[model samples]
Every structure is written in structure tokens, then in C-alpha cells.
Target: MLEVNHLRFSYGKNPVLRDIHFRAVSGEMVCILGPNGTGKSTLFKCMLGLLRGWDGKIALNGEDIRQMKPGERAKKMAYIPQAANPAFAYSVLDMVTMGTTAGLHGLRVPGKKERTIAEAALEKLGIGHLLERDYTSLSGGEQQLVLIARALAQGSNTLIMDEPTSSLDYGNQVRVELQLRKLTEEGYSIIQSMHNPEQAYLFADRVVGLRDGYVIADGSPKDILNEELIEKLYRISVRKVDAEDGKGRFFEVIY
Candidate 1:
């Protein structure tokens, strides 16, 4: 449901992204993989219209995003950052309900329907029990899930997440990955920038590898991810092992 073509961006005279092109459709999970300073986050901002004066075309559901107004874009795309730190002590439900504001206009407050939507979103992520808890009191993984719920409650078809599993422990990382798989099954298009290539191999329908702000590899994990590509992208040696269950593959850094 998303298409980016010839996306080129720069700050002053220095270019960040060059000739970037990719596509994601409904029910697909696409992972953008790269190391630091590869312009992954900058590319996301360009897609979200948070940055302008960039060259290229970004279309959502067949319409150019540049032509869409802020609210209009909000209705079609939702973003989930790493983890949110709330200024005040707000309940999980309160934070989630805020997503509904994208659908409402003027001074109208969230009512039963909005609350119901938020609650449903939390339940879908299997975190309904934390609904009444203080958002800041939860663990990093819980906080990330709540943010995903908030994005879902916004009623967007596409979700863009920046390092969704960045700081979580192993168990929490698995939890988030499972939820992401569930979202894809339920028809939410997902694009996430990830540091972990193993996570992409395990969950992503497609992986786009970037180096020096250019797409170096793009395809299904089994097709594009290998020892050579990994070394080229990260400047490190690694080994890939097939899963015993035959689901997919995983990688390990050779020391």
C-alpha cells in the first residue's frame, strides 16, 4: 500500500538518501536494515512529510503523500517511535485514547466509541491488563506495545515504526515480533527500521538493506541476506544458520 521511487534527500550540500525505491503492500511486513548514519530515520521523516525540500515521490494507496494535508495523511499512516516518555503520569488507556484525536475535529472529546477502540487495540496486543496502569511504570517492552496500540487506535492502514525493539530484553523482543506478525495477518502494512538482521530474517516479508544512504540489497530474506551481503552492509563478518524448524534463517556475528 506504499510506494517510494527515486527518493533523494540532502542537508545543505550533503546527500543522505540517493535513488531510494521500494514498495510495500497490504499484509506485508517490510524491514529497512542499516547501521548508524544510513539515513533510515531521515527517509522515514521524508515519507511522513515531516521533512520537505526532498526530491522523489512517495505515494500511499496510489496517492502522492505530498498532496495530502496533515490530517489526511494521519488518517492513512501512523508512526510508532522507539519508546515514548510521557511528561506526566498518564494511564495506559489515556495515552492510547489520544490516538483517536486524529479522527476527531474541533473540541470534541473522546467518548465511549474511542475508548472502546483503544481498549480493543490494547487487547489485540495482549496487554489489556495494563490498561489502567501508569504508562511510565511499565517496562520498556510494555511501553512500546502501548504505543503500537495507540497507532492502531488511530485507524491507519499503514504503520511505520522506528526501531520498535531497540532496547527491550529478549522475551520482550519476541513478544513484539509476535504481535507484529499478528498485525500482518490482520492486514496492516508495516514498515520498520531495525538494527537486528536476525529479527528481519525471522519476521520480515521483505528486507531492504541500505548503506551510505543507498539501497544495497532488497528482496526476501533468503534471497538477499547472506554472509557477503551482511559483511558489506555492516562491515563485519557473520554466519547464517537455517532454523531447525525450517521456518527461516538467523545470523551470528563472528568474533
Candidate 2:
């Protein structure tokens, strides 16, 4: 239930994003796929109301985001940025509990109810044991899961994740991707920026291919993740091999 229409943005005199359009429906995962420097993050920032100078309309369920207050927006969508090592050590429960305050207009404070919601959120992600652990001491995967738990606690069904698996190991990447899939199955709408075409192909129901800040292709992964598009997006010669496995056949890139 999110729509970004004809979005354009610039930094000083240099334009970074242009004519970007996309939408995410309930219970769907839409992947914005592009190489680095293709304005993927810029598009997300504009959609999230973080950078409001852009020249287009961002709407949530047909309501312009600009007219909605910060708390109102927080009630409808949750943004999960890339995880990094923390500078200051904070309790894991303390971190996730912050999400419960998203809808608090002012004087936001977590009480016993908020703490219980945060605990349930951690349990939803199957990381309940990490509630007392130091956030700075957890593994990269655990930290990422905690971040997702925090987003869950925000009580928003629509999630925007920027490069959700960028800094994780392969196993952790798989873990996060599977969690995202499960979220969609549970009727959460997700819009994620990803550079890995294979992951998008495997996980996303719809793929929006972006290059030079323009939408070059938008369709189902089976229709968009082809040899020509992959080669064009990466500027390299490649072939798509239909590989069959226990799960079924999928596109395998051959260079």
C-alpha cells in the first residue's frame, strides 16, 4: 500500500534520481534491483519522507506522505536501515523497545506494556534469548535480526529495508531472506533495495530494475531476470541457465 510517483532528486546541481516509479502491495515483496550508484537508496529516502526536497508524490494507501505527520507515517511503515557495529553498548531489549514508541506523538516513553510488546517482537523473530544481551556484542546476524525485531515492534505491516543482507555472511543472508519471505506470507508488504540479482530473483515476487536512476524494467522475476537484462544491468556478458533442484528450476547465471 505504498506508491512513489515520478520521483526526482538532486544533490546541489547534480541530479541523483529521476523519474522513478514503483509500488508495493500488501503481502508482496518488491525488490528494487540495480548496481551501486544507481539511486536505489535515494529513491528509498524520498519514499520514506526523510528527504522531502524530491520532486514527486509519495503516498501511503492513496494518502500523500507529505501531509501526514511523522507519527502517522510511523504507524503505517517501518524503515530498517543497514546494520552496523554500534558505537555505544545498549541492551538488546532497550534497543527494540524504542520501536514501540513510533506512534507516540510526544513524550514517548516505554512502560511495562511497551516492554512486553518488544519481548513479543523478539520472540516473533525467534531471538527471545537475545533480549538481555549487549547489542554491541552480538554477531552481525543477531544484530540484523534484532533490527528486524525492532521494526516488527513498530507495529507497521509495511517495511522498507535498505540492503537488508549487505553486511551479513552467506548463512546470515539466507536467514534474513527467509525471514522476509515469511513476513510477506504473513501479509506484510516489503520494499527492499538489493544489488544481488540472484537474491531478488529467488526471493522477490516482483522485480523493479533500475539503472541511471530510471526504471528500465518492472515485472515478475521470471520475466525481468533474464540474460539480456542481467548483462545490461551489470555491463558484462552472461547467460541464464535453467538449473533444476529439489525446490524446482531457477535461473542460474553463467559468465
Which predicted model would earn the best lDDT?
Answer: 1
Q: Model 2 lDDT vs. the true structure?
A: 0.87
> Which digits, one per residue and each the tens of the lDDT, describe model 1 over residues 61-174?
899999999999998999999988889999999999999999999999999999999999999999999999999999999999999999999999899999999899989998
Tell me which residue pairs clash in candidate 2: none
Q: How displaced is residue 79 in candidate 2, in Å?
A: 1.1
CA deviation > 4 Å runs, candidate 1: none
| TM-score of model number 1 | 0.97
Q: Evaluate model 1: give its lDDT.
A: 0.94
lDDT against the true structure, per candidate, is 0.94, 0.87
Q: Model 2 off-target regions past 4 Å?
A: 246-255
Clashing pairs in 1: 1-25
Identify the leading candidate in terms of TM-score. 1
